[model samples]
Target: MFGSLGAVTLLVSAVLGQGFATPKANGTSGYELKQGPLDTPWTEKVGTTPWPEYPRPQMARSEWRNLNGVWQYRNASGGESEMERPPFRQELESSVLVPFCLESALSGVMGNYTIHSWYRTTFNVPDSWTERVLLNFAAVDYQATVFVNEKQVANHTGGYWAFNIDITDQLNKNGTNELVVFVFDPTNLWPYNVPIGKQKLIPEHIFYTPCSGIWQTVWLESAPADSIEKLHINAGADGKVDITVHTTSNTTTTADFILYEPNSELVKLKIKVPVNKAHSFVVDSPQLWSPDSPTLYNITVKLGSDAVQSYTGFRTISKGVVNGVQRPLLNGEFVFMFGTLDQGYWPDGLHSPPSFDAMVSDLKVLKEVGYNMVRKHIKVEPALFYQAADQLGLMLIQDMPALSTSSVFINDETAKQCPGVSLTPSLDPDTVQKEFDRQLAVMVNQLKSYPSIVTWVIYNEGWGQPWEGNDGVRNTSIDGILTDYVRKIDPTRLIDSVTGWHDHGAGDFYDNHHYSSPQCGTPWYSTPSSPYNSETDHRIAIQGEFGGIGQNVSEEHAWKVAASINAINNTYELDATPKIWNLRAHMILQELEFQIQEYACSGAVWTQTTDVEGEVNGMLTYDRRVNRMDKDMWRRDIQGLYEAAARRARTNGTMGVEGRGGGGG
Candidate 1:
């Protein structure tokens, strides 16, 4: 049964990257890390369980324990070399923080980048946790193998997707039971082509440091032998929702659902349906969720002895003709998506977030700036990020974690900066392609429940899409096949099969990444590397990425990593012009709105929200302490874009004159 869970699971391969000098091991003591260039206010709040919030916000189970405290760790350069016997009931070396990657400053292990690492901790299962005990790893980097009391229980492959293991049989009911985990993260060094999205072993320009080992929350959950496994919710802006509850048991079971409207705990609707079967319900006069008014319905599900709490929002995302040109309509209106490309990286925590509230604050910052959307770039964030977006009403263009690039792009120069992109472009073997498709489907299933996600980005910069060579092999583009697969799984949302470079003419949106210094003509009627001229294309055209306006407000807050090009070295402004980047950003956006509809561009995503390790083109500094863009002016600029979009809708008789989110019929 354990193996079966991973059998159909899609497998992705990776190649090894060049190694670097390893940090010397300082075993047998708790880690003491230095202050990074800057730290979030919540950095001090990190403790045994850094992220103590409920791991799953959508599906909440009260009976769960966080296993994210300090744990004993040992590094074995060669993975499985000492697999002769499991390290049980003995102290091997050092203590490191849980959840954070081994390479991050927050982990206290700010040490070596070894291929293999071992972790050990012990906990007691409460007598109250009855029926079955389950160990859940929100996500582990490349590979993870779990052992309970020295008995191998579960192993998983994949760094981004969450997986669980049944630990009931192996749990020691009486005394404390030891738990050990062996993690092997090859990063870009895997023998097979694996997805590593912008991560590289050696940090450099464009590509930042790799995230290894356990990078997300790890915890324990208890449920009855037969209980609810997961829930699939398809919510419609018309106040209707269809729900399907998957159960652990193969046979039929009954589930009772009670839904509570936005601010009230009072039950709004209730129903009982057979498990695994979908049921639909409608709320009369539903306050639809939109960028202007983000509303949600909280729901509770009960299946005999098991119960979970979740939430959803009713919003419609579709492509419709407006003024004889296709555009993305939200809640039946063309809510122009003005957003920033968020890396979701931190100087201290790396891939791990400083805190859940911090992520919320990040979204809040963008919202205050009058933006309605965020393009989560090349990384799959934890649940908290999405929860923040849903509550704060920030629509998301969730990007699929890109695999390492294979072929060189014809027009994209950034392709030369990326590692592992020099490989020859060709179609994947039948077996390999099948595996990739299956995994892609699983990712879609896992994230489609979130109301905040408005679009699915299948690929970016043609990184791993070598098969889609120059001109994108339009007839044989894999994006068409993958886009179809995603649409079948969740036809509710839009798909951008290719975000930048080498367009295969697949998916709903046609987009391009345009970057230049603030002085050049931008946000105008120009799109580079587009398969078709925007004037004639049937699909919505968006400037997926722009505004690589680099700046370093405070040299002290910039990354200290010695690289060919980092934020500090690539500063765009000097002592004479401190606010050039900020002022130019406003101007560029103003120009963008002026020509948006005229150029047939429906939306735009700025180069980035905050600075990552090396790339300096961001509105915020790397440490997040300083905002290069003035909030008031930035908000004004963003407002103009929406106003223009709304005015166009009214003129074309496509929507009500109530401004944003008004029905664009």
Candidate 2:
């Protein structure tokens, strides 16, 4: 039969071809042989799985398996094909490094694969693991069907969430065990069968690249037959941090919970509770969490032989009247949140970071730039990325990766180039609602526990939905559904209902995006203006996106183009770059200061932290090796600006009103 040893024989035969190469003893060697600057020497360092420091830092596990190494892979030709068929192959022609996506350069197989592909790998069970084995995939793009020893086990449909399967019964204790995963992603065309965001088969402007297959860590863990299946921690301003522990067993178990301040001793508490029941704890004088000062409490839960470590923050986020004006309050205090529009992309790894160190480096850079928060622009990152922010105490404004029609305000060329070719349009009301609910739910479920995420941007600049009509009529209701969905899922966080254009008059704050200027508007406009240019009254305002100034540093650029300079006309190219570095820096600093000092803009997200593809409007180059602007000066000015604005808002006792003194729209 094709499903038997014949598949192995066929695979062995196929490996004799020119492209087929034996698996290198060291996994990193294969990554260096791949083509493109996107493919660098990623595998040079091996064994240490730098990210092996527990994939889920927020939710810790003392006893778990790390399945983040080489995995057998073979390209599926398509249709009802058995793994043991004549064309079925697996002689190490290619070995996909687990945890990284196949499309990413780090995977060594930096080549594109059609929607459906079959991957197979085998390993022996460790004798020490006598309990139930749970197979976990951090994330697999689109849809995946998993099988163990040729028997189907589980299936997952989302690309940005985690899923697990219990395979204790299917394991072969004495012999090699086989694991096969089949993935199908039809994201190349429009109106995909599944909800997808900003992924295109062709990498081009704005919609940079597509990430398929396993993009996150894959691992296995053995748990006591009656172990903690899941947990939830809720931190409130009332000094009560609620916890709900879900376990598989129905027996009553003694639970002990511990809380730790940053770099401090652990505060432990023990309580007897029924298994699977919710438990609550009260911490008096809890440390409040906010953008200005993000404080997190480490939590450790023990049940019988099972122990898990996690963290939360005691905070309350709400809209309240401060000095007679409604403003965003954190722990009962009004604070301005400033951040960057961080699209977590890498030159080498694309959607995946080369290592956990690489991921932490990005967050550290943002902190260094004096940004209190970061708007995770459109893409949902791995859990550890948020963990880094939570541990490092950085605020987060997360956006659900958008999946709808391209914005109308985008340049006509960009509009034509990146339209809803394979996306469910906003006009399909049912699809829109379904996708909106599905994605919003997934986003919230994946990120809600992290205290760093204080705000949710439901929509960004109307990229996926048209908030304005052709006749210039604004549709605030359309934007309301998104904001409402976010609030329904996670009422604790603030919402930037419509980030760029179309003031829906909804959401907790007045959010706006400006690229060319840092001009602030009045609280209310006597005459209605364009959505992008209009000024609003009655709410705290924020400059959501601005300062897309670009400065090219020689060594940091990844492209092969030679540096050019046209000093006379001030046009800078690859080689002869312009001396306008200082000019660009000054403009950004002055505009930022103006928005902060003059306008009292609550917070601002500079265009970005790094250049994405062709949009070279980042403070740093795409490779992250260079900073085009003056780091120290920008940091000092931003710190001073935010401090001054915060002090003024505190003194005024009101959310800064439009036309009061703020500048830039």
Candidate 3:
């Protein structure tokens, strides 16, 4: 009776205390909290256990349990027996809230000792219906080995993607079950290189303080023996949809696909298709997904006794030479892709956000500021973040976190300690290369279904970009090989082979970066030495990064600058206050008008949306306390650029200010 559902609810509620609510989290954003947790509107709601929202919205289940409250924690060693067998009965000394990493302020263990850590939590399976039970971690940094009831369940590498463990056989028939997770994240330390995107142990400019351990949601859900394993939806060029459903069962089974137009929630079509096969459906008038009208179709997939609620949108991305310039064509028209470099980091929670609503607030700000896309810079966010963009109509440029070895960010001690290891990305170890290949494949496969993500950036400024697969030899074809690999996986979206420089002239876009390009003083102004070689470059030209104007240096929310400030220039300095805010609006609006005129620069991404650590050149402060520029004013100014760009696109685009939706096949 103690393991009953009612008892479990009471235990979960009691375990998550209201004591974690801070004053700054009380809907007050200003100069209130110095060196404390910054509050968004959703912060006050984050009690002890934050991000209680369902981790997987794409494949949502009605009945599930959240195992995020009152997790026991302890520091572990790789050589210790705790790696294989958990410290079962003995209580872990410290208590850390689930999801928040050990290095985060909200974790209660904000200590920098992030090498090895252990997390243990307990949950009960509802006795009503249980064919099989699944344990899912939204993400775990670096490497994690999970144990369910003293039995090792999963061993996963790479830190930025989701993984699951079926603990059906390992779970107890009655009473409660114990779940222990072991996480090892060396970050960008010295000798161990992994897919670390902007996460540095030293925590300087551009690189943020490393987050380790379970940084996303943890939950337990019951599934059928023949449950849906994965669903891949492709909203095609002809405006029809092809859904490939993969189920857990190997035997032949038919799944009922009931599609509902999400806008009206009306059943538009229904079909019963065999599992593990791609099925296409054509509608009379398909509601295409665009930045203006993001139409999603809700679908309920039922396989005998198992059913899941899922959603998908209909759209396509292609490229063509429009008006003598190669540009990205959205749904057969040239639509400008303007967005911010969203470094999905939180000051309080590090990689994990304060709350689900906090993530929504960031997207709303971008939409309000007239941005149509978000280049998720160097980090992978929870599935809900992409889902949020899908619903909000924001296109995303998802970056595969840089795959690095510990030797890449070497110090004096590391150089002396690991004398034999290769330091450069050109000569990464074989294991690291294999891991990158596995992780990259997983990232593309897992995230390919999301409608909002129109581009997958393979490399960023050559962080972990290996020159060659061979022994330290340089080869540019390696760049093309990676691009080819991504295209081979999902040929639906545009591929930016390299974001900034070190671009080996690969991928769909010839992307470039600068501090504040196309401005008067910058080198991008005059056509003589412009970064964009649109006249000769085979690929479409785009400004992957620019307009990094700084603000709010002295405010309480500003992340203090460390030893390095590479982008700061003496050519023309920017004020870290309102002066820059006014100037930021003026500079970007003016430069963009010129950039969009000739169609040479097809699209552009600003430096960032929010300041991360020492990088203060963001539209908003790091903690999101201050909006340096006025959203309405900025929106009022940039609204015309979209129309002009679309007009200059293909002849298919209308000249008037409008939505980018059209009826296809």
Candidate 4:
């Protein structure tokens, strides 16, 4: 759920307590608040001192600094290269709150910057600390160059991953030091073929307003010159999980592993090993991790003079035959995956949510609606968001934000209603390869932990795709390269080479996307005469996308007019006569159930969880203030579907297929 500026402002006031009145319009230090859902006051409350939770839950450490909050910003004249510059000889431009995007109202400068811009802030180092200080940006969109105390520290190019630089060598030991960042994004100047999902300079028809600059929290942490930098955990069904710790130091250190089941001690092992060494520990009778009963094992590792905390789960995801049908195996048993296409977007925050709580709310809402998993559509979220999913017991199917230059389109009857509104396709080969490698590496490195992620989708619907086009036939050799690359990087997880419409038939699963109707694929549910009613003959069938029925509640609308779906006025008011929209939603769910039963699909991911900008087809409205579908009804339907599917699998004498189907007894 997204928070509007007003709602956020109220939250800010509530959190910060009294005496923190809204800044007056002409005040120098105080910012002139922008009026918008994303510009709300609570955003301003995100202070520089106590920024996001310390120890970064996933990788825990005792010493670190929170560098979030108010920062001095200036629209660059496009020439300055230094951090400290003469105060603009002209009237001072408005100051922007740190972390939020410049386009967001909360930033105080609710305007877009086509050219590069600069941000400045100052902080003092503790006299007691003698170790190196590192500055980290959770994320900086497009491109970023950082300087500390007038010395250039680091330069980074991706927007969705975290990067850090050691600034201790350049820090001013005793006094306050200056930090500045220069960001340049071609959001407006770049060609429209960038494969940008929701972002738009002029948002309309499924495109959302652009988010530029720092849309995530930035902070600092202090660590020894030689310290553990990263830890990667891999758990297998054999009760042995490998731990790889990357460290800057070369000293010998002892690593410890502890396994925990719900309210019980499962196993514990401690071993002395060389720093940066990979270690594996075997546990007996390990409790497997799953969405229904999410079991996690807490692990703490200690290095010489340093120690960090981490966690992992003993589980395995595989693919095999169940009832002569391919299916995903969880802990060596078939567990039908049910989820939604979660395009993480906030009404008020654009790419950023008002607060961490707001991000968690979206996941909470999904769980409440009976979804066990979520396909994080395109955009990569902050680490904390993934942390929430892991702790809250939700599975994740992470998708690499579509990159390339190919356009995608749906060909069903609904798609025909909206002619000429297809996705832009085709990408420069070099550019595609570069972006794909960079984005894929960043995604894998950042999300390798946290038991929630089970699958990694390499491409979605051929957006910016470079396929072999021959009279409506699209084929590509890139799918194999991508699949092999992901497999090498993280062999434990499943990879969907191409999601929706396009099928390379080379990836781990057979994925498909449908909308508003239930139609079976080639051999299973459909034949020459009865094509639309039966299942496909594919090994493993999944409803990758479905149910985009529109139901708009007027009073809750942030945008004045109802948006079109498939270029039609299919939008209906929540309180309209007979509430036809309600009936439509019910029918959509019913159709889903019917398709699941008839097709024997292993899993299904709904069209979406929340309305994203112009795409108001989410089960939950954009802000998440209202639920379009009834929660109780959805839960009951999913429960019934799961039971029925399980029953069928058991009855067919295909139970315990291990590789594909059957529950672990």
TM-scores of the candidates in the order shown: 0.87, 0.82, 0.86, 0.83
Cα lDDT for residue 218, candidate 4: 73
Candidate achieving higher lDDT, 1 or 4: 1
Q: Give the total clashing residue pairs for model 2.
A: 28
Residue clash pairs of candidate 3: 190-406, 192-406, 193-404, 193-405, 193-406
Model 3 is weakest, by summed lDDT over 10 consecutive residues, at 17-26
lDDT of 2 at 342: 89
**lDDT (Cα atoms) of all candidates against the true structure:** 0.72, 0.63, 0.71, 0.64
- Stretch of 10 with least lDDT, candidate 4: 656-665
Per-residue alpha-carbon lDDT of candidate 1 for residues 205-266, written as tens digits (9 for 90 to 100): 77777788888887787888888888999788888887889998776867999888667777
Q: How do these models rank on TM-score, best leading? A: 1, 3, 4, 2
Model 4 / residue 642 / CA error / Å:
1.1
After superposition, candidate 2 runs with Cα above 4 Å error: 1-33, 38-50, 79-92, 193-195, 249-254, 261-265, 272-279, 290-294, 323-325, 404-429, 466-478, 519-538, 553-556, 560-579, 597-600, 650-665
Residue by residue across 456-567, what tens digits does model 2's lDDT show?
Answer: 8777776555434457565658777767877877777788877776666778667766654554433322222232222335556677776665554443365332222122
Local accuracy of candidate 4 as per-residue lDDT tens digits, 5-39 = 12222332244322211222333455655766422
Model 4 residue 165 lDDT? 89
In candidate 4, position 192 carries an lDDT of 26
Off by over 4 Å in 1: 1-27, 34-38, 406-432, 468-475, 517-528, 531-536, 564-576, 651-665
Reference-based lDDT, residue 81, model 2: 56
